[model samples]
Target chain A: MIEIRNLTKRFGSLTAVDDVSFDVGRGEVLGFLGPNGAGKSTTMKMVTGFLAPDGGTIRIGGLDVASDPVEVKRWIGYLPEGAPLYGEMTVRAFLRFIAEIRGLRGAEARRRIDSAIEQVSLGTVLEMPIDTLSKGFKRRVGLAQAILHDPHILILDEPTDGLDPNQKHEVRTLIRGMSAEKVIVLSTHILEEVDAVCTRATIIANGRIVSDGTPEELLRRSRMHNALRLGLVVGDAGSAGVVETLKAVPGVALVEVDAQSGNALEVMLFPAGGVPLAGPAGEAARANGWEVTELHVERGRLDDVFRAITVGEGGASHG
Target chain B: MANVWIIYKRELSAYFGTPIAYVFLAIFVFLSGIFAFYIGNFFEREQADLQAFFQFHPWLYLFLIPALSMRLWAEERRAGTIELLFTLPVTMTEVVLGKFLAAWKFTAIALSLTFPFWITVNYLGDPDNGVILAGYLGSLLMAGAFLAIGSCISALTRNQVIAFVVSGVVCLGFVLSGFPLVLDFVGAVAPPIVVDTVRSFSFLTHFQAISKGVLDAGDVIYFVSLIVFWLFVNAVVIEWRKAG
Candidate 1:
C-alpha cells in the first residue's frame, strides 16, 4: 500500500504539486490523468525518492520515502518520463547492471534478468546496444530494467507514450497482469488508456487533484443532469406545441429546439435524473403528429467527466 | 563494502565496454613509451634509476587524468542516469569511491604497461628495483590525487567539456605552484614563510620528493590527504544538490 499525505513541491514561486493526498491500496491499478504541466510527473518523482518534496510525506508499504528512502526504494520500481538509459550498454548488460545494484547475485540475478527480458519481450534486441534500438524497443528495455527486482510497487510515467498499438496492448496486458500482486500507478494523457486499464483515476489540473474516483463513479457523479438530443421530421406545423408539452412531462426539466430545417426540428431534452427522458419525449412528439427521425439516450463518458473536471466545461465531447 | 564492490565491478565493465578506455590506454602507453625511450635517452644515459622516466609523470597526468575522470558524474547527469543511480540502495560515498577506484585502476593498468621499460632498464643497467617500485607507487598516488580533483569538478556540471577544462586548469595551478618562476613571483610580493607555505601545498613538490627514491611520510600523507579532501568535497556537493 502507498499513502501520500499533504504532498507539496515548490520550485521558487510555482507549486508543482499542491497539498495532494491519495491512497493506493494493494493490488490496485491507479491512473494519474492530467494535461500538460499538471504535476503528475512531479508527484511520481517525489514518490520514487528521486525528487525531494518540500512538504508532507510519502509512505510505501509503511516505509517513509524521506526518512527511509533506501528501504522505500528497495520496495518500488520506477520508470521516469523519458526512460533514461545508458546508450553504450547492450540491453542484457544494462539489465544485469540494474540487477546487481538491486542486490541480486549469482543465479538469482541471472534468473531475474531473464525473466524481465521475457516479460518485456526484449529477447530479440538483447544483444543490441541501447542507442541502436527503436523508441518502442527502448521503452520495453526501460520497463524490463524497472521490474528486474520484482518490486512490490511500480511507478511508471507515460509508459506507453511511444509504443505502437500492438505494443501498447502488450504493455497494458503486462501491467494488468502485475496489478494483482503490486500497486501500479501510471500517468498518461490518454483517456481511453485510463478506461482500459485503471481501476480508479485521480484527475489533476494546475498542480492539484480536482477529482478522484473509479472511472464509472467519476462519470456518474459528473453527470449533473440527464439529457438527450433528438432530431425530428414534422409532418406539419404541430411540432412546435410538442416541445412545450414535453417540458410539462414529470421528469422533464427543460426543452430547447437545437436546430431547424425544412419540415425538421432537432430538440434537446433535459431530465432531472440526468437520465434522458427520451422515452416520454418520443411519445409526446408522436402524439403531436411529429415523425421522430432520431431518438437516442446520451450517457456521459469518461472523457466528458475529465473535461468537465479539468477544464470546467461540460459541453465539450472528446469524441 | 559489498555495495562498493558491486558499483566498482559495474563501473569497470562500463569503461571497457566502450572505446574510450582502449583509446585512452593506447594514447597513454604511446606517450609513456616515447618519453621513456626517446626523450630520456634510456640506452645512452644508462641511468641507475628510473628518475628520468618518473620525472615526467606528474606533468603527463595533469592532462590525461582529467580526461579520464571528467565523465564520471557529468555524463551520468547529462544523460539522466544519475536519477537511476541515486535511487538505488547504495550510499553516495560508495558511488564516489567506486568510480574513483575504477579510474585509479585504469591509470594503474596504463602505468603497469611500462613494465617493459623496467625490464629494459634492468637489462641494460643495474637500476635499483626498490626505487623503481617506489616510483610506480608514487606515480599511482599522484594520478589518484589528480583524478579526485577531476571527479569533484565533474560533479559540479553536466557538461563534460566544461568539467574537463575546469579540472585541467585547476590541476595546472597545483603543478606550477612549486616551480621557481612562480615561487620567485610570490617572493617579490609576500613574506618568505607565506611563499614557502604556498609551495608546500603543491602536488609537484610532494610527488617529486617520493619519486626521488625517498619514501617520506609527509609526501605520502600529502597525497593521501589530497585524495580524501577532494572526495569529501564531492560527497558534500552531491548532498547539497540532493537537498536543493
Candidate 2:
C-alpha cells in the first residue's frame, strides 16, 4: 500500500503539484491521467522517493517515506519518465547490476534476472547494448529492471509512451497480469489504457486532481453519457422533422442536429434525469416508419470528458 | 559495506565498458612518460631514482584526474540515470565511496603501469628502492586528493565540460599553493602564521615531503582528511540538489 497526503511541489514560482493526495492499496492498478505538465511524473517521483515533497507525508506499507526512504525504496520499483538507462551497458549486464544493488546474489540473482528477461521477452537482445536498441526494446529493458526484484509497489511513468499498437497491447497485458498482487501506478495520456488496464483512473489538470474514479464512473460525468446517436438517410429538410420527433420522445431531454454528410442526417439525443433513452427512442423511431440507417447508445466518451475537465473547450491537447 | 562493494564493481566495470577507461589509461601513461623522460631530462640527469618521473605527477593529475572524475556524477545527471540510482535502496554514502574507490583504483592501475621506470632504474644503478616506493605512495595519495576534489565538483553540475574545466582550475590552485608565486603574494600582505597556514593546505607541501622519503604522519593525515572532507561535501551536494 502507498499513502500520500497533502503532497505539494514547486519549481520556483510555479506549483507543479499542489496539495495532491491519493492512496493505492494492494491489487489496485491506478492510472494517472493528465495533460503534458499536469504533475503526473512529479507525483510519481515523490512516491518513489526520487524527489522530496515540499510539504507532505508519504508512507509505503507502514513506514514513513522521509524517515525510512531506503527501506521504502526497497519495496518499490520505479521506471522513471523516458526510461533513462545506462546506454553503454549490454542488457544482461545492466540487469545484473540492478539485481546486485537490490541485494540479490548468486543463484537468486540469476533466477530473478532470468525471470525478468523472460517476462519482457528480452532473450534475443541479452548481449545487445541498450543504446543500440530501438525505442520499444529500450522501454522493455527499463521495464525488465524495474520488475527484476519483484517489489510490492511498481511506479511506472508513461510505460508505453512510444510504442507500436501491438507492443502497447503486450505491455498492457503484462501490467494487467501483475496487477493482481502489486500496487501499480502508471501515468499516461492514453484514455483507452485507463479502460484496458487501470482499476481506477485519476485525472489531474493544472497541478490539481480534477477527477478521480473508476473508468465507468468517469464516463458517466461526460455530457454525452447514456445519449443516442441516430443516423438517418434523410435530407437536411427531413432532419428537421427527425429532430422534432426525437425531442418529443419520453426520455430525451434535447436533440442536436449535426452537419449533413452525403444524403444522411446525424442527430444526438440526450437523456432526461439519467434515464436510459435507447429502448424508448428506438421504439419511437420504428413506429414512425423512418428511414433509419444507424442508431446506438453512447457509453460516454473519455476524450470528451477529458477535454471538458482539462483546459475547457477550444483548447487542443493530446487526448 | 556490501552495497558499496556492489556499486564499486559496477562503476569500475562501467569504466572498462566504454572507451573511457582505455583512453584515459593510454593518455595518462603516454603523457607521464613524455613529461618525465623529455621534460625532466631523466637520461640527462644521470639519476637512477624516479624523481624525474614522480615530480610531474601533481601537474599531470591536474588535467587527467578531472577528466576521469568529470563524468562521475555529471554524466549520470545528463543521462537521467541519477534518478534511477537514487531511487534504488542504496545510501548516498555507499555510492560516493564506491565511485571514488573505483576512480582511485583506476588511477592506481595507471600509476603501477609505470613500473618499467622502476625496473629501468634498478637495472641501471644502485638507486634507493625505499625512496622510490615512498614517491609512488605520495603520488598516489596526491592523485586521490585531486580525484576527490573533482568528484565533489562533478556533483554540482550536469554539464561534464563545466565540471572538467572548473575542477582543473580548482586542482591547479591547490597544486600551486606552496609555490613562490602564491607564497610571495600572500607573504607580502599576510603574517607569517597566515602564510604558513596557506602553505600547509597545499598539495605540494605534504606531497613533496613524502616524496623525499619522509613519511611524516601529518602529511599522510592531510591527504586522507582531504579525501574524506571532499567526499563528505560530494554527498551533501548530491542530497541538496538531486531533486532539482
Candidate 3:
C-alpha cells in the first residue's frame, strides 16, 4: 500500500505536481489519468524516490520514503518513463545486474530473473543487446526488470506506450495477474486501459486531482449516464412528431433530436431520475402507433467523463 | 562496501562492454610508446630508466582521462538512466565512489598494459623496478585525481562534450601549475608563499618525486587527499544537482 499526502513539487516557477493526494491499497490497480505535462511522471518519480518532493510525505507500507528511501526502494519495482535501459548490455546480463541491485544473488537471482523473463516473454531476446531489440521488446525488458525482485509495489509509467494492441493486452493481463499481491500504479492517457485493469482511477488535470473513484462510479458520473435514446422509423410525418410524444412521458425532463439518417429519427430523452425512462419511452412509442427502430439505455462511457473532467466541466451533465 | 562493489563491477564491466575501452587502450599504448621513444628521445638518452615513459603520463592523462571521465555522469543523465540508477537502493556517494573507482581501475589497467615498457626496460638494462612501481602508483593516484575532477565536472552538465572540455582544462591546469610559464605569470603579482603553494598543487611536482623513487609521504598524501577531496566534492555536486 502507498499513501501520498499533499504531495507538492515545483520545477522553477512551474508547479509540476501541486497539492496532489491519493492512497492505493493492496489488490488495487490505480490508474493515473492525465495528459502530457500533467505531472503524472513527476508524481511517480517522487513515489519511487527518484526525485525528492519539495513538500509532503509519502509512506509505503508504513515506511516514510524521505526517512527510509533505500528500504522503501527495496519494496518498489519501478519502470520509469521511456524504460531507459543499458543498451550495451545483453538482456540476461542487464537483468542479472538488476537482480544484484535488488540484493538477490546466485540461484535465487537466476530463478527470479528467469521467472521474470518468462513472465514478460523475454526469453527469446535474452542473448541480444537491448538496443538491438525493437521498442516493444525493450518495454517488455523494462517490465521484466521491474518485476524481477517481486516487490510489494509496482510503478509502471506508460506501461503500454509503444506496444501493439496484443502486447497491450498481454501487459494488462500481466498487471491483472500481479494485482492480487502488489499495489500497482500505472499512469497513462489511454482511457480503455483504466477500464481494463484499474480497480480505482484518479483523473488529474493541471497538476491536480480532478476526479477519483472506481471505474463504474466514474462512468455513472458521465453526462450520458441513464439517458434513453430512441431511433424511430420515420413515418410520412418525420420523427419531429415523436419527439413531442416522448417528451410527454413521465420522468422525461427533455427530449432532443439526435443525428438522423434517411427515414430514421434518432432522439435522446433526458430523464429526471424519477422513473425508468427506457421502459416508459418504449411503451409510449408503442402507444403512439409509430414504427420504432432502435431503443436502448446508455450505461455511460469513460471517454465522455474524461473529456468532461479534463475540459474543466466539473461534472456538468444535462441536469 | 557491497553496494560500492556492486556498482563498481557494473561500471567497470560497462567500460569493457563497449569498444571504447579497447580503443582507449590501443591509443594509450601507441601514444605512450610514441611520447616516450620519439617525443622524449628515450633511445638517445639511453639512461636505462623509464623516465621518458613516466614523464608523459601527466600529458597523456590530460586528454585521455577526460575522455574516460566525460561519460561518467553526463551520459547517464543524457540517456535518462540516472533516474533508474537513483531509484535503486544506492546512495549518491556510493554511486560516485563506485564510478570513480571503476574509471580509476580502468586507467590503472590501461597503465598496466604498458607492461611491455617495464619488460623492455628489464630486458634492455639493469633498471630499478622499485622506481618503476613507484611511478605506476603515482600515475594511478594522479589518474584518480583527474577522474575525480572529471566526475565532479561531468555532474554539472548533461553535455559530455562540455564535460570533456572543461575537465581537460582543469586537469591541464593541475599539470601546468608547476610550469615556469604559469609560475612566472602568478609570480608577477603574488608573493613567494602563494606562488609556491600554487606550484605545490601541480601533478608533475609530486609525480616527479614519486617517479624518481623518493616516495615522499607528502607527495603520496597529496595525490590521495586530492582524490578523496575531489570525490567528496563530486558526491556533493551530484546531491546538489539532484535537489534542483
Best by DockQ: 2
TM (chain A), candidate 1: 0.83
Q: What's the TM-score of every candidate structure?
A: 0.89, 0.96, 0.95
TM-score leader: 2
User: What digit string (tens of lDDT, one per residue) describes model 3 on residues A41-79?
Assistant: 999999999888999999999999999999999999999
lDDT against the true structure, per candidate, is 0.86, 0.91, 0.90
Count steric clashes of candidate 3: 0
Q: What lDDT tens digits, residue by residue, belong to model 3 across residues B129-203?
A: 998899888888888989999999998888999999999999999999988899999999999999999999999
Estimate, for each residue in A230-291, the C-alpha lDDT of model 1 and write its tens digit: 88887767556767777887788877888888788888777776645877777877787778
Query: Residue-wise lDDT of candidate 2 within B40-124, one digit each (tens)?
Result: 9998999878888988888999999999999999999999999999999988999999999999999999999888889988999
Interface DockQ per candidate: 0.58, 0.86, 0.71
Q: How accurate is candidate 2 locally (lDDT)?
A: 0.91
Cα lDDT for residue B220, candidate 2? 91
Candidate 3 docking class: medium
lDDT of 1 by residue, B108-226 (tens): 99999888788878887888888888899999999999999999999888889999999999999988898889999999999999888989888878888888878789989999999
